[model samples]
Target: AMTVFAEKYGVKYLAAVKCLHKDADALLAFYDFPAEHREHLRTSNPVGSVFATLRHRTARTKGALSQKTARLMVFTLVQAASKTWRRLQGANQL
Candidate 1:
């Protein structure tokens, strides 16, 4: 399948895959984490999600939030949410 793809796509595409192949080990280095952490790390977009929540919260209000207030709001929300966050399966090893 990959050979067919490379043939159809041309040298640029094949070269890109070859480049990635060289970094395959480093690309998968994140799996060194515990199994439980790997699942979360692979699937979750924590930064995007946090910003989405902040965007929704700000959108609900009438006007723009000041820089100080926005910073404080994000800090407060993260602190409150931290209570429900799961610990890594073997975090202490890190």
Candidate 2:
């Protein structure tokens, strides 16, 4: 499929064809999972929330936090946030 795409459109859209070829495995990785779990994997937003938590904390502290403190904060915040996260769908497939 990628070979055909590259051959057909590579002339007009060389950069796009190159990008797709380079990252095709990552782009198609979700398909390797169970169908029922794909949507859950796609929409999972806890990482965003955890980052938001880290962002808010870091922004307030600015340069006040030491590297050790920052790592501890991120670890603790993510651990706390995980308690509230929903279980994955189709977990039995795992």
Question: Per-model C-alpha lDDT, please?
Answer: 0.74, 0.89
lDDT of 2 by residue, 1-94 (tens): 8899999999999999999989999999999989988888788777788899889988988859888998899899999888888887778888
- The deviation in Å at residue 63 for candidate 2 is 3.2
At residue 33, candidate 2 shows an lDDT of 86
lDDT for residue 92 in candidate 2, whole number 0-100: 85
Residue range 6-90, candidate 1, lDDT tens digits: 5677576878678666777887799777776787788777777777777788888754789899889989878776686666666
Worst 10 residues of 2 by lDDT: 40-49
Whole-model lDDT for model 2 versus the true structure? Answer: 0.89
Cα lDDT over the full model 1: 0.74
